[model samples]
Target: MESQESHRIVVTLAQKARDGADAQQLADFIVSSWQTIEASLSPIIGQRSVATLYKRSFYLASREHPWLMDMHEGMQTTVNLAALKAALLERTSAEIAAGAGAALQMFYEALTNLIGASLTERLMRSVWADLFPVPTQENSA
Candidate 1:
């Protein structure tokens, strides 16, 4: 069974990925997030594997969000983030959030299944850290 921590991690990543941007800016956020994830995982799993997994995640997500198929179809390369961003630009903020979040959640779950929770969490945490700052502990009064 999936842990709540895993679900939380996926949700947090998707929320933070938007970085408080409006709909017009969401494409940038999504592309940037995907690039970071690709970079982080490619080294460990091989670029081909990362691309494959990325596509698979989207494919699975598209079953529920059929609009995602348009985005996936626009991808010329295995992981054509430019195409994804373009497709995202055509969508509204709510659609972007829902579809992107679903895809991201699927990707995280797939990674956890393939590599085990421990390694997936470590790698994903690295991606999260690279994209967002971690609050530091302040001195107690």
Candidate 2:
């Protein structure tokens, strides 16, 4: 169960990183992941185990997957996999909890890994093809 959950999280994070075509997809992804964790974990830890859940989840996911990138992710993801893992090891539940803004950071980190240098540029670009201008030779000049 743990292994499977971790795999799903990594996949979800990767998809989110890609800034996929639909915003709802990322919402659904996060919601489903939460549902699974809550269902399997709430019975044992009650309501207060959210942080514990993340800690345990990270531990399980990262143990065998120290490599960071999912199969769908590319070489851009591997650049700082080791460093990120090391940094993640030192994080506290306070710093890295889902509720404490860590989860958002996780998505952002995964996005950075997935896209490398294009992350910032992509953020500045509009998603709609019509809204986004295609630079022409005149514009380049």
Candidate 3:
């Protein structure tokens, strides 16, 4: 199903963000990715809706990784990127990957449910073009 594909995209993006990242770099990448996603989605869904989805996703992810709640405490109309980045810096790579990936997957599922999978895919693909790279053709000798 398209929703499944959308989830894959979210997972792939998270993996890409985590790849080759040190703790500081990983936190920067995670926070930057969220900011990019928020910028892309907010106009279409409204900032408040995006914020709600973010909060919901973070809350759901925090059930599995309670440290995530620290980032949620001071959030308002949007995620506190600084808080999230700080929290991420304190986590191991595996925890960062799992928690960030889970939150993103939840957000994608919720977004797809709200906007339909087709639009969500289009929007996300545009926002994260690097994740769905076009393969280059190879010439045989």
Per-residue alpha-carbon lDDT of candidate 1 for residues 1-141, written as tens digits (9 for 90 to 100): 665444554455446444565666766767888899888888788887888778877898899889888655544336888778887888777678778877877888888899998888788887766653342343111
lDDT of candidate 3 over 60-135, digit per residue (tens): 7799889887655656787677778878888887678778877777787878788887787788886656533332
Per-model lDDT: 0.72, 0.36, 0.72
Question: Which candidate order results from sorting by lDDT in descending order?
Answer: 1, 3, 2
Worst 10 residues of 2 by lDDT: 71-80
Q: What is the lDDT of residue 23 in candidate 3?
A: 69
Instruction: Give stretches of model 1 more than 4 Å off.
Output: 1-6, 9-20, 73-77, 130-141
**Index of the highest-TM-score prediction:** 3
Q: What are the models' TM-scores? A: 0.77, 0.30, 0.78
Ranking by TM-score: 3, 1, 2
Q: Write the per-residue lDDT of candidate 2 for residues 15-111, one digit (tens) a residue.
A: 3334442334333434444454345435544544434434433443444444322311332311222333344344332222222123423433343
Provide the clashing-pair count of each candidate structure. Answer: 0, 0, 0
Q: Model 2 segments beyond 4 Å from truth?
A: 1-8, 16-21, 51-141
Clashing pairs in 1: none
What TM-score does candidate 1 reach?
Answer: 0.77
